[model samples]
Target chain A: MLKPEILDPQGQAVQRALPRLGFEGVSDVRQGKRFELEVDGPVDDAALARIHDLAESFLANTVIEDFTVKVEEMVGEEK
Target chain B: MLKPEILDPQGQAVQRALPRLGFEGVSDVRQGKRFELEVDGPVDDAALARIHDLAESFLANTVIEDFTVKVEEMVGEEK
Candidate 1:
């Protein structure tokens, strides 16, 4: 996500339009991206660290954005 | 998030590129969006319901995407 101090024009536009669409009471809005990754092996601490590194290096642009990575779920055959 | 059955070309491109970038073990990738909205007053169940309705009607297209809404944090004077 973009840093808290950075300007978020996209979020600002959404916030302004929300009340116009009759969904009132929202004073502020922020937007971010979510990525879901399926790993071939178990998600250990080291694996989590690697994902964090990947997020910092490849997924998110460190100059303008900050990111957090976590395990969402472990998929079985359904995945 | 895009429905499971939907084809995600963007995520597919990322999954294919990750290996080239030396980030291994990720077999698949799916991408979605995150929106954080700040309510003017308290975030009770009624407010949450309103947000969900907004998400369904305005934020996400129910035919292709699904959305989930929850409170992340409550702001004080810093907000």
Candidate 2:
């Protein structure tokens, strides 16, 4: 399980501007996490399906954000 | 590229105790990051080899710490 750093530049901008917007004392609002998973597979169609589930069930905060999965064929193999 | 939250629990514990050691204003010493990559492959021997490279060259801060990789056969896929 991996959670990425919560440094939202957009959030920070909003946080800084909030006092002007009549809000204060709202400190330490950080960003969410990002997780990368390396699953062992030829990464066929079914494997892709599971990667989706892994993110939905355990990896991401669906309500707050979304994620993407990239399938890279490890860089030193043939076919 | 996923950079995990820098929350060093051990660091936090040490930070809290620092005042006793005459340390002051030493704030914002955070932890490093964690990245999990899902490479597309049957994750054969060669694939594992590349995953190691991905982490060392791009994913991790080799000078500061180390990371561990787990190869989960994407759940729901057959061998």
Candidate 3:
């Protein structure tokens, strides 16, 4: 997601359009991109660190955006 | 995010490019949009229902994408 200080024109555009479309009560809106990565192996601390670096260097522009990495689910693992 | 049957070209592009960039072992990647909405009042079930409606009607293209709405964090609320 974009850092608080960065200008998110896309998010601002959405926020402005919402009230006009009858969706009220939302005071603010910020938009960002989300990615789900399926790893071929365990995501250990070292893998997380490398992923962080990858995010900074390739996925997101660190000059404007900040990102968080998380595990969503273990597919077909268990209930 | 896009439905499973939808062709996520953007996600596929990233997946294809990753191995070349030395970030290996990622088997798949899916991309989607995330929004952080700040509501002006307390978030109850009705609010959530309304937000879900908003997401379906405007936030995501229901023909290709499916959306889920959840409250992330409440500002000024006790942790």
Candidate 4:
């Protein structure tokens, strides 16, 4: 997940408008991008670290946004 | 988080192109919207349930996409 900085114009706009859309208790609404990745191998610690580096270097723009990388293990047998 | 169905054209396009951008191990890349909401009160169970309802009814378009809602409690003292 990547979110625009709080000072970002887009985020501010969404925050201001959420109350008008019936979200009365909602004070801030910051919209961003979500990237779901399906990896081919085991999601071990090393793999997670690699993905984190990839997210910082390639996936997200660090200038104005922040990102998070989550790794979920596959449930069934690996093929 | 809301993701498009596998048959979605936008998701397909992203999955097809991820490898080209050096995400060799990544088989699928599904893009979607991420919304961060800051509510005015405690993020309790009832607040979460209400947020879920709001997400389904207003934030996400259930016809073609699926959404997940996560609630994180605020850390600082409430004003």
Candidate 5:
């Protein structure tokens, strides 16, 4: 998630612009990014730890954003 | 959220690059955007429906991506 201050401008812009498009009652609109990871094997502790590191170093800009990493198991499905 | 095929390339790149950094067990990584909206008043049906439309027309690229809009109530806090 984007830091509140960092995200405020975009939110404010959305809030201001939407009413013209017939959308009212919308105040704050903060935007950020999400990453969904599919693991090759069981997402054990070791894998989670690596993912956490990757999230901190690669996926998220920790300086101005906060991110959550979740591991979803593909149960009998191909993607 | 980005359509699976649209997000696949970035996911594959991350998967390939991370292992070289000594991180394994990660197969797929799909990335997309998140928007957090703070409304001015009670978020009723009317507000939600407007948000849905805003999401469709402005926030997401409907032709190639999917998006979800959620309203978060700010309780006893100033932002």
Candidate 6:
């Protein structure tokens, strides 16, 4: 779950023009990314490392964009 | 980037009640994850591998939720 923040110039531009678009009460509008993947069962340290590699290589651009990742089991699997 | 897809029960719950929220013309409301990070000059494949680890460890929950990653350089830096 890596999220790269580009200058949401498009989102900002839309946000700015939103008022004219007849949209009111909208505060901020930032664009982001999302992903979902499957592991064998539970993820371990090594598996985590692999996921991060994907984030850096394909998920986010380190130069200007920053990203974050999150992990959890399938829904209802938790007690 | 890796994007994990959870049931989005919350989002669905909200979507179900959106009509009552007086927010018409809106179609869907789904939640996602986004990240931004920096690398040396440009990111290599190895770096990416590490990032995915972070995402899996902390950023997302595989149980009921899934996520994705994205990488990109800062804006205007590209020539």
Which model, 2 or 5, shows the larger lDDT? 5
In model 6 chain B, the worst 10-residue window by lDDT is: B21-30
By DockQ, the better pick of 3 and 5 is: 3
Off by over 4 Å in 4: A1-6, A74-79, B1-14, B75-79
Chain B in candidate 6 has what TM-score? 0.60
TM-score of each: 0.91, 0.34, 0.89, 0.78, 0.79, 0.41
DockQ of 3: 0.84
Per-residue lDDT over A1-79 for candidate 2, one digit per residue giving the tens place of the 0 to 100 score: 2223544664456456545654444452333343434344466787677667655754456655556666656446567
Residue B2's lDDT within candidate 6 is 22
Q: How do all the candidates rank in terms of lDDT, highest first?
A: 1, 3, 5, 4, 6, 2
The sequence of per-residue lDDT tens digits that candidate 1 reaches over residues B1-79 is: 8988999999999999998999999999989988888898888999989999999998888999978787777545565
Better of 3 and 6 by TM-score: 3
Best by lDDT: 1
lDDT of 5 by residue, A1-79 (tens): 8876574676677778888888777666777788888877767898788789889999899999977776555557866
Instruction: Judge candidate 5 at residue B36 and give its lDDT.
Output: 79
Instruction: Kindly indicate the candidate among 3 and 5 with the higher TM-score.
Output: 3
Q: Model 3, range B39-75, lDDT digits (tens) per residue?
A: 8888999999989999999899999987889887865
Give Cα-based local distance difference scores for all models: 0.88, 0.51, 0.87, 0.72, 0.77, 0.53
Off by over 4 Å in 2: A1-79, B1-32
The C-alpha interface RMSD of every prediction is 0.9, 18.2, 1.0, 1.4, 1.5, 14.5
Candidate 6: residue A71 Cα off by (Å): 0.7
Residues B1-79, model 5: lDDT tens digits: 6776564677678778888887777767777777877777767898788778888998888888977666554556665
TM-score, cand. 6 vs. native? 0.41
Worst 10 residues of 1 chain B by lDDT: B70-79
